[model samples]
Target: MNDWTSGYVAEIGYTYDFFHAMTPTRMGLAALSKGVQHPFGRETFSYCELGCGQGFTANVIAAANPHIDVHAMDFNPAHIAEARALAEQGGVQNVHFYERSFADFAGSPGLPSEFDVIALHGILSWVSRDNQRLVYDFIAKHLKPGGVVYASFNTQPGWAAAMPMRRILTDHAERGTGPLEKRIDDAIAFAETLRKSGADFFANNPDQVTRLTKMRAMPRNYLAHEFFNKDWTPFHFADVAADMGQAKLDYLGAANLLDQMDELCMSKAQLEILDNECDQVRRESLRDVMLNEQFRADLFVKGGVPFTERGAVGAWFATPFALARRYSTGPVKMTWRGLEVDMAGLDYDPVLQKLSEGPATVRDLLAQGLFGAMQWADITRMMKYLVGAGFIVPCLPLDGIAERSEGCRQFNLAVCKQSEETQKLSFLASPVTGGGVAVDRMEQLFLLARSEGHETPESWALFAWQILAPQGQRLEQDGKVLETAEENIAVLQVRAQSFAARRVRILEQLGISLQPIATAQEASVASSAAA
Candidate 1:
């Protein structure tokens, strides 16, 4: 039988995952941070995602930003089916899903044209070169000038130390003869045996040992896609930039905010060594070498228009931001080379304290006494650092985003209802971020229960347990699978106690948690008294 998958893994699907980097709103901020004005045209805009696995990111983005028309495509029929079901569940009419390869989509008459934003979560590193060209062709013909592209892939130097081991694991996987899952397991176990037997390669590369150990603990399904794919390759930053330049695109910056910080990008000594390199691509390539960066998330623009310092600062300062979650009441700390890097003495306290109260534009943060004397450049750097540290997140200003919930509610409800059958419903749409966040199985269940009038966490937990019990499922805690009814309930009660500690607040911040309504009598009395 001739295989049409073209070296792609078709037997098992990609993870039902949502990556935050795929959102256009986030891309806009990322571009602004780099001194470019992202083309978020007012009143109307369009976005597309190539290889949108299970369509989680696409659907959620559509549901959240109802004004933006969104489109998503994946070659897997199963993935497309799930994406469509999800869009239907979310009542997300603004988005369209197509089950077609890049080639087919490129050829199809129904394909979208002039998209303002085109993104790929992990396509360049996974697909054949032919498919990659097809992707470039799609972008070349369809992307509008000033359009932004978000693409992520495995990169060189980071994957260099482990290439030999990856080859061994994949070679074993290709030689095995059972289901894809079994083959992946055999490959991992084989790698473990080599490590235990004092393999010379393991001895020479201590980092590879760390890599294999982490691999052993990773989910087999994720490993199947990561190692077993037939067309796995890593690129240097220069190579990717050159390849993308074919489509008249320019590199903006990394999707992960942390990469923006040169201090974090390399050791102090390394930065000093490469400080004189003026070429942007070469600078990034050198940084990649220092960190052994295995994976990268980057943004590109179809026709990038330069912004003057004044214009860039105006655009950047006008953007509002909010605390992604309530911060811990202490200094944010990071560890590097066995030493802790604390921001307490750096004067970030008052800024975070103000953001915690509500969303604040850069102007709002700077106008305060603590930051008033600081330059816009200095203040922006601190905010980006906070975003990189996960202490804060970029949010859509409340004024810009219209209030709408029908699509998000429907989509989240579909997700909750699906959790009744499978626990892979791991994310929910976030209106505030115009993206999705990781909402674990337990929290998903609780949210669903609450929507149905399960008053408290205990009631919600019990309600979720009743659904699981019918399917011969039980909760697990501390690696212990609770088989008995009493044990499961006990575990859920404990989980319930802590769920409110953080998850409730997070849900409220994301605008997903339903609010209590006033009683009719109260409303009537207030109306009558006013009259």
Candidate 2:
């Protein structure tokens, strides 16, 4: 195993890039919305990313939520220098980058328990056991009450295959000559030699054989990071939970929603059989079915904070509410659980209609007549409904622009090659329907529409009207353009309503449940009529 100091110094850039690419903003928001407390306030929060390489994730969060002060730290000075440079280049001001190791910071005086969210992605498994203890101690001492910590690590079952591979590579590299690449080739050759040794683990399982073959083909850097490390210890889930408890933290949840590995994915019979088993062993058995015993993102919260009922905060935010507009786009489709809902059919049609465009701040949305005459509480409810149903993703930044859009694509790619996870989130926040539409071209369309003097809420809407006018005329049998503002507004209203309805349906199919919009009196009257 490699020493901690050398591992920290060697290829610090790669380590920084790996953690920086894991966006903690979305994870932080989800955890907060799910009842996690933040340091600043319930809605606002402070955060820090341990081992924050090049400060990429910190920069994005700082750009997204200027209100949230994000601190990024790494033991490696080179990594810190690169992160600071990246932050400056991006003009991100809210993040404070520090070049200090975890042990130094933990032992140093004057550190505050100021961070509401602490993220240690891919750090624990790589560090020495003593360093891991230091990390846990820091979390216990510094994390604010109700705060959440995001820690990811390698685990068993997955490591069962990975451990031997690592040993083989490390031994081979020690004996081989030439560069890292050539040594890696020699290491792979050793893995093949092991497979031919007639071992039951490799011979009996074709799936394992195929997996080993793929692992052998990975780059030397990957092999070094995975197998050559001196302190590479894979953990069991229950043991992890117990270890967290020992550190004055409680297991909150997992970062990957898909990897919950709960009763939902297990048959009732299987769950019943495991009911009597110990928590650690039970998780091991479940991982056997899930086939994901290797990598995990575990969320933990400080203990002693009173546990409130789940969904309490959600219910409070679900009342009708108003927020600013954040971005511009065309009609959007939202689905929930494979069912479509008509947003127009709901009482909040007018509001949802206004938000169908690309991302928009809550304040902007309200200012644009979407919540016309609606109570402030009602507007809050509507916004919460949209957020809960995933119609409008919560962007923490007051400006509503995605911090990690194509605008930053070049910078991100320059610093770190595109990964599947980063690509997917970027697509979700993109302005254009597919990949990305050029910003200048989109602006040109808006300008052209504005020059036409169409009385629409947004320039994009006017552009759509201009393109659709000829078709509308042909359908109406009148060569005359729809000249009346009221006529255009009425037509746009219907179109907007229809668009909202379709989007609502789609959102429902995607598992987002929106509340029916209605006042107390109106709901009573409708119910009476139905009865």
Candidate 3:
């Protein structure tokens, strides 16, 4: 039999996690922060995700934004099948799923000729060079003019210390027997033994010892795919920029967002070094080296049009923002790399207070003098900090809000129903944000119970226990598992009460409701058609 995986890990599926950065709303905001225009500013746009593992992000985005056309392709058939099933379950009609390799996808007919936004998450550093070239060629041919691309990959310098350790693990795994998971555990065990035995390599590199400790806590499935893959190469920023430049791509900014804020990430000396550098690519590479960046999520635009200073201010003013979650009037603590952001200390109380009343544009806040004595640049930077830290989120344009809400309602119902079987999915589609909100499995169960007319928190807790008890599951609190049904229900009721007090209002603003929008017959028809 021919090996079609091309040295990629195919024995196990990837984790069912959602990455919010891949959402169009987040991408558009990242672009706007750089004073550049994103493709999704208009009513409708097309998005494509290359190597969409599990397709969770694509499906959620499509469900949230009814106006966009989403196309996602992966080389794994199992991944495509699961994605299509979820889309059908949610009555999500706007997304197309394909199972094809990079070369095949590039040559496939009857697909969209061009896309407005293309995203690649955890793909570039894992695939072989030939496959990477095929991706570049695809972008060169199919990406529309002024389109944006989000590519995340493992970066150099930070990975330098662990490179040899990774080689050792891969080599050991290849020599071992039994299943891939078993081999992975054996390799990790061997590394641990080496560390305990005071091997020269482990002694020489202290980071690997720390990394091994963290690796032990990660899921075996993630380990198999992340390390066992044969073609893992971490690229420097300049090299990746050069590869993108081949396709007429200009390095726009980082989706990580904090990297753009020099004060937050760099020391004064490092800032002076970066400031003296003229070439952007070399500067980025040197900055990565200085920070020892292990991973990167970056944006690139084809034919990018940067806004003038006045135009940028206008764009920022017109954009609306809403609180991401409930906040108290205390120290709004958020940190990035030992950099503490005291929102309260920074006098963001007025802005947060105004947003709590309702979604407010910077223009509205300025008109009300909410920012006090802050200059235009200072206010914009403060807004960026809030958005990047997830304290606040940019809202979708109010136009067509009703339709988007309906679509998201149906999709969320399907997700809540799925929580009955598995709690792997931890996000719900939010039409207002045009993205996914982090709603845990228990929260989803509460939503489901409320939709079923369970009137109180105690009732919701009881309903959730009924579903989980049969599966031999119990609630975990402070890392301790609750054994008895009474224990579980008591803990759950407390959580449900907290959710009701804090989360409900935010969910309502996000256009979520605890009411089933799709009938059984409608779901049945959708399932049959998908089958």
Candidate 4:
């Protein structure tokens, strides 16, 4: 490889995937929840993504939101080539893909001067120190005054356990001349041998056993980039915040929704761990120790003007989201950072019940006399928890979705067509949700079958089994993998019935069925028809 990579893996291209959490609307919601300024709620905006491998999210955002100017780049030309081709195939015109290094992008006069948002996901901790500084300089120069930077990276305390193993893997892989995948495979196998050999390193780093086990299941390309990167630095919250500070940015809040809810994430017992740390930064650092957070997805803002509590309430109410149809939200029983927190007492049922009626804003639910007793804070808190859990999703405004109508439809059709062939693309861009939706391989087959006039669930089951049986793959049920065609088809039959009734309708609704400006009453009627 060239000196440009500096031992970074470039031979293997990244996964063709979309991260829904990296959406601009989601970033806007997180900022709004904290009363920080954001540009995504505006009429028009420009967004950029650094290290946007395969550029799936950027292309989807541009297709779904006609108003946003999307620019994305990756150092790998192969990834950018595939990304650009996909955009062309999908007929997405607004998004532009570039294959450029950090230094070149930072100094380029041709790029946009200011951006509404800049996202760097899983790149900060995986690059050289010089490249990291160039990233900081890029943000400092190009981010608009009120822009938010969504940067996610591996973090300390949780990663401290596996740091030694990461070094061992990288060192072993670099010494070999084999294909990248084989090198990664052999390195992992060697690590397992070391673990079984009762080495003193394993005794000292007991977490390596679990890490190695889980690491084996990950894709080779993912492992190559993660562990084999020349520069892999897991940071502390305070240190990363300081790095952003050099760009005149402030730590806004977490882009990951669940991190926003303290009550759900931290137990009372775990909360006690921060008793001695009074400073905000120190408290956050100590909390990482309590939570053992291996990775962090954070948001920072440049010149963020704080909004009043009243302003935050109005923003929260006006922002729209559809019930994502992915989760059953009655009483929330979720365990985070070893804390099993249940919100059964919080009556989110009424709010969720209203959304099940149709896509509506927070204000819409309150105006209907639902959550009549709860104050804004109480309601917003529960909504935050719901949104974090993927039970709800942020949606584009009526005009935005309407203007991008054809672009959105064509893109989804192309994606669904591609999904029928490969499981690489597990998510579809949803104009209704203003983000990606998880659609597994079988579900994708079902959608294809439905469009092909296989309207019944049994037909969908047969179609999916045909795809699975040819590969010798079986249905996974209970804790075991079922091997027979009969066993697989039987399970797929039950799944298809529910999928056809609920999921197909949702697939249609997300593609374009649910209009943004429809009144709550109108949404209620539409909701009944869907059910």
Top model number, TM-score: 3
User: What's the CA RMSD of model 2 in angstroms?
Assistant: 14.1
Which model, 2 or 3, shows the larger TM-score? 3
Model 2 Cα lDDT, one tens digit per residue, 1-531? 134463442441343233322344335433544455434233456787887755555665565454566787877677678778766654556678887777787543444466777888788888877888888888877788777788888887766765665776677876878765677677777778888988776766666678668876665555666666556778877677777887778766556432332443555776766665656435454654445467877677785243265443443333222222222343433443234422332355555555443344455655677667876545544454454344444433323223333233323232222221122112111211101111222222222332234223243345545554654431121455566655765555454443333322332221111112222224223323322
Pairwise lDDT winner, candidates 3 and 4: 3
TM-score computed on alpha carbons, candidate 1: 0.91
- Write the residue-wise lDDT of candidate 1 on 1-531 in tens digits: 126677878788778877877766667778888877677635578888898877888887888788888888888788899888877766788988888888788665565668888989878998988888899988888999988889999999888888899999989988999888888888889998988999899999998888888987887767867777789889888998998899999889988766777675466789886788888889889888877788989999887887898898777767777677667577787664345655443678787788766667777776777575666667777777777676777766675443544456667778877887898878777667667767888778877776665556677679878988999997778887889988998788677656656556656556564323223223223323322
Top candidate, metric lDDT = 3
Cα lDDT, all candidates: 0.77, 0.52, 0.86, 0.79
Off by over 4 Å in 4: 107-110, 267-278, 326-330, 464-491, 512-531
The runs of at least 3 residues in candidate 3 whose Cα sits more than 4 Å from the true structure, single-residue gaps closed, are 343-345, 516-531
Candidate 3's displacement at residue 224, Å, is: 1.8
Provide the TM-score for each candidate, comma-separated.
0.91, 0.59, 0.95, 0.91
Q: Number of backbone collisions per candidate, in order?
A: 2, 53, 0, 0
lDDT for position 186 in model 1: 89
Model 1 pairs whose backbones collide: 90-411, 158-292
Model 1, residue 403: what's the lDDT?
Answer: 56
RMSD of each: 4.3, 14.1, 5.2, 3.7
Residue 100 CA error for candidate 4 (Å)?
A: 0.5
| Candidate 4 lDDT over residue span 96-154, tens digit each | 88889998875554578889899988998989888889899999999999999999999
